[model samples]
Target: MGLQKYWRIVFVAVLLALAMIYREEAERIVNIVVSSPPWLFFACLFLVVAEFLLQALRMKLVFSKNWAEILRAYAVGLMVALSFPSRTLGEGARIAVMAKELKVKKEEMAAYVSVERVADVVVLATAASLVLLEVHPFLLAAAVLGICTFLAVIESDTVYRKVSRGPVPELLRKYIEESRKIVKDRALFAAILGISVVLWGIDFLRMWVVVHTMGGTIDYTAVASLVSLAYIVSALSFLPGGLGVYEGGLAGGLVLKGVPHDVAVAATLYERLFSYWLWILVGAAAGAFKRENGSSSTA
Candidate 1:
């Protein structure tokens, strides 16, 4: 980690300590997860393994023609993603690993990784729309309806042709053409989208299990949307795997949806146990082994 990140974490830790001390309403978060049933604890473990498998499948699909490299790159991506914040560093880290393992160019790897992240955006938007409908019905419904009408118009060749002909300069035209090529590649888009949906679904189910264990009244789908929004916020926060921010967002979302505060806190803690901590332990071990085996780059 960089010095900047180190200091930011320190700052965040201090702030978190203050938050815990001053916020009288905040229940003891860690204690709740500790008291959850053994069966539920195992369920969390199952979910993490499922999450890793889904990511591996996503990477494999991202590079369909290069299955062998995909396997290596996927593992590398998971390691980096779990070790860092929001998986933001995952692509570059994977590219380095791919270069060593498969002698591939970083630029080519970048094109695939870029497309992979765009897939994530599309999935998040879809999840957000679903969640908004559940969490904020009126506004979400209007937005969804308006977006659907807009997409329908865009999908129509007549509308596209009309929009395409106008004041487009040469440079802008080339950019548009390239973008069209990227978007129109149905196989590539399908692979990315398919894997992303599956990954998110597993995560949602994991969240659902936590609520079930806690005996919370919130529905599975409702928990899913809340998970989606919490994920988005955590991504924006830039903390490693979103750390404190993610847990806080999960708890807050549940409270907003009328869950009792203690249950929300317990559920969020359980989520960390099953997902974040698992990733940290596994990814860190993989990273350390790579270093010892001289399989990783120091640069």
Candidate 2:
């Protein structure tokens, strides 16, 4: 644990060093954000709140749980995701927390979370591919084909049955069974997809607003594609909340699209301020509150 803590300190120190090395750029970025109109900041904040509410609603729809509980679980998950190196563990944390809170089996909750994650990935990928269609037609085709194939496999009971019969652990079998039930529900699946579309749309709009706030002009599609690609790359990087990878990818992408370097950096920082850092703070608060209540109950 000491070694782990040491590495974390080193990680933070590295980030600080990088900031110091680019102090001029950092100052310029801060100036750009500070000079932005207050209304745009409010707009970004509104979108962030909307995202949280929508995600809670999505979880409620999937698990039939109270929205408040779902929101708390989600917040804690985000906090864990940012705290740890692997973002995947955040979903695992969400499953564990929600299952314990709602008195449901972990496998069952895993199924619901899986559905939510898969739907999000598919929707985001499709949207990104569509936006980049002019820039990458092959990418659109590949995305569509991959999505269709994945949906077909998941929709197939025969495939599930075959997989289930072949040395699958009992826990996994249960998870698969629950996932099939959720996916087979056409109405629920459609609603989830719709919510996902709106959620990602809000993400794009928020990015657009941040870029404009930094005095940069870029097309909506470009912003969407850039953000989407950056998210994918950062997730693959497995860094905490994508950390350095996300900022670098986003700022670089923006610069490639004709945004000034300082403006790009400013836009990325401002967007992350609301989207990533704000959530981390909220998650930390939620986690602490939960722990305090648990202690009080025990006492």
Candidate 3:
């Protein structure tokens, strides 16, 4: 974890250095970026909204009710995660909000969130592995390994038994057992994974739209690989919201893939504007509308 911290810091430093050296190219890109049409701007916003909407949908699928409160908690928690150091705080905030507002027990909620994240890793890594096969073989291999590793950890009785013997109070045993029960309902599990895929697909499309809005073009397959690459690299960063690392990886990756430097930067910024900044704005509103804490409902 410490090594990952330094790696993120180093990634930022390196990206900044590259930006400085290519200042002229970046400026020209920004010039073109400023001319994006309003329709395209709104289209990007719609995709961003859709992404979170799907996220909310997934939460509802998992928890079944108290949706209004769940959505609020998710938004506020997302805000916390993005605003604070230790991106893990975002997950903590979700658990906190649900516990405070919906009367969800911490252990069960923690299990829900953990299960979701592990499932996400498997889905994304598998997707990235396949998409990157021709573009980046090493990353493809790593992604495949990540999928396998996450599954192995989750499925291993040895890991569960070992944790049970340790100081972990719940040992996630209850959570894991519950998760198994949930997945046993095939229809529900499919719906959840389906929502997740769509959510991430919107994310990719959001970036693609931003690039097109900025009058740039790249192959869809390559763009998907790049987007997945950026997400994979930045997801592990300890940086608050994976801030610079995500943007830098995205913009830099596009440029490396033959996109004009300025346009790549512009598209990345626009995508982040709607997805990250606007997302926080909505979360802020959700937090404000609620009581200082959340209201309880039967979920």
Query: Against the unseen true structure, what C-alpha lDDT does each candidate score?
Result: 0.65, 0.80, 0.71
lDDT tens readout by residue for model 2, 1-299:
24324544666698678779998877777788899999988899999899878877887887777766778888876666565665676567667876876678999889888888777877667657744576678876776687677667678989998988899899988988888888899999888878988888899899998897678899988898888877766876555677778889989989998999999988887898887779878987987898999899999
- Ten contiguous residues with the weakest lDDT in model 2: 1-10
Regions more than 4 Å wrong, model 3: 1-27, 130-142, 149-168, 292-299
TM-score of 1: 0.70
Counting clashing residue pairs in each candidate, in order, gives 0, 0, 1
lDDT of 1 by residue, 1-299 (tens): 57425744674587578658856544454455666788887777887778777776665654444654555545555555544554465445655665455565555455555556666656665777776666677755665565455435534557556657877665444434433444457775687678888888888888888877786778877787788777767766555667667888888989888887878977887687667656545655655666676754544
lDDT string for model 3 (1-299, tens) is: 35434644675687578768998875676677677777887887778777877887777787756778777877876766666545676567666766565566776677666666755665666656655776678976776677567556656778767866777656466766566545556786677777877787777777877776676778766677678777777766666677777888988988887887778988887787776677567877887777544344322
- Models 1 onward score TM values of 0.70, 0.90, 0.80
Comparing 1 with 3 on lDDT, the higher-scoring candidate is 3
Q: Give the TM-score of candidate 3.
A: 0.80
Model 1 lDDT on a 0 to 1 scale: 0.65
lDDT of 2 at 250: 88
Model 2 stretches astray by more than 4 angstroms:
1-12, 130-142
Distance from true location, Cα of 36 in model 3, Å: 0.3
Error of 3 at 163 (Å): 6.1
Please report the candidate that would top TM-score against the real structure: 2
